[model samples]
Target: MEKTKPMVAVVDDDPRLLESLEELLESAGYAACCFGSARGLLNHGLSHLDLLITDIGMPGMNGFELRDQVKKVRPELPVFLITGRHEIADQGRAQGISGFFRKPFDAPALLIAISEACKNRDGG
Candidate 1:
């Protein structure tokens, strides 16, 4: 039997960042779903997602807010926050999220973190 690729929903307001992350995720062997806003992801639904990666500095709904809303429905879901603004990293960790990565983060390290997050969820 073939294994299914993990579905990762990535939300970022920056169009370029969104596209770049999607490509990176796909290259890393995960199914990537890109969203321009938290609302866009919410509207599309999260039934198929194994993980969520969001940006903290979005214009409307920020990553932290999105994580809260997502947790309300899917408590076990793993949410990772990525931001160009490094200060928000502490806040993201305070919320007890799966992980946080700064902009220009090492893609390989991010992939490792993602794998760990998924593994922990499965084990639990």
Candidate 2:
């Protein structure tokens, strides 16, 4: 039987960016779930989110803090953080995050990161 495709949850305060990422993830063959707020995401989020794509500098809950919280609950889940701000993105790099996307990220790069995260979760 074929393996089920990975599912990704993308949370971003910016509606336009969130939509763009949803399209990007879907086009790459992974399922994409989107949320506009961190609180909403943490509450009714997908339990089996194979990957999480978030912005690092959200107004309420920043990605680093959000990622840390999620890791405490689900460390195995992959978290890819996006940031248009160089400082924030660079800081997240050292946080053992799954991937990093500067604003205007390339589709292939994001997809590759998702693939790697899935592989890691699968013990590859």
Candidate 3:
């Protein structure tokens, strides 16, 4: 039987960022789902995702709120938070995340972390 690629969900308000992350995830061999808002992601559901990467500053339901919500429903799912603002990261709201990346984050590093998180999730 063939193994399926891990599905990664990303929520970011910026369309460019969403497109970029989706392409990056796909090029790295994982399935990527992009959502423009946390509500959009929630509406679509979360059970199918292997991992989640969300931006900290969105219009409604920011990354921290979304992370809290995900923990409530799918606590085991690995979540990575990304943000362009340094102040948010400095405020220390990024606790309990699998990883945190600042915008302009190194793609290779992100991919490596994602790979490891997915592998660990599957007990591989």
Candidate 4:
């Protein structure tokens, strides 16, 4: 039987970044859902994702709040956060995130993080 395609939700306020992530994920053989804001993501795509890769900076509901909310709905789902700020990494780590990728994150590192997050989500 064919395997199911992995579903990753990529949320960011930056259109360029979101687009790049979608392309990257698609090239990596994952189906990526892109959203411009946390509210949009929550309203539309939260429950459908196998993994989440979100940017820390957003207009209204920031990534932290969004992550917490997503966790509430599905605690076992893996969330990989991306941020340019290093200071908040500790806080995110403390919250039980699978991985935190620094902005301008290398493709391999990001891909590995995604693969790891998928493994963790699948309990493998």
Candidate 4's error at 89, in angstroms? 3.2
Best by lDDT: 3
Q: Rank the candidates by lDDT, best first.
A: 3, 1, 4, 2
**lDDT computed for candidate 1:** 0.89
For TM-score, candidate 1 versus 3, the one ahead is: 3
State the displacement of the C-alpha of residue 58, model 3, in Å, after optimal TM-score superposition.
0.5
lDDT of 1 by residue, 18-117 (tens): 8888899999899999999999999999889999999988989988899999999999899988988777776766777448999978889999999998
Model 4 misplaced stretches (Cα beyond 4 Å) = 90-98
Distance from true position, residue 39, model 2, in Å? 0.6
**Per-residue accuracy of model 3 over 1-124 as CA lDDT, tens digit each:** 9889999999999999999999999998999999999999999999899999999899989999999999999999999989998766655545543487888889999999999999999998
lDDT of 3 at 65: 98
TM-score of each: 0.91, 0.88, 0.93, 0.89
Instruction: Give the residue spans of candidate 1 off by over 4 A.
Output: 90-98
Please write out the lDDT profile of model 2 over residues 1-124, one tens digit for every residue: 9988788898898899888888887888888889987887899855878888888878899888899889888887888889899776676577754488889788888788788889988998
lDDT of 4 at 67: 87
Error of 1 at 2 (Å): 1.6
Clash count (model 2, backbone only): 0
lDDT of 2: 0.83
Candidate 2: residue 56 lDDT (0-100): 83
lDDT of the candidates, in the order given: 0.89, 0.83, 0.91, 0.85
How many steric overlaps are in each model, in order?
0, 0, 0, 0
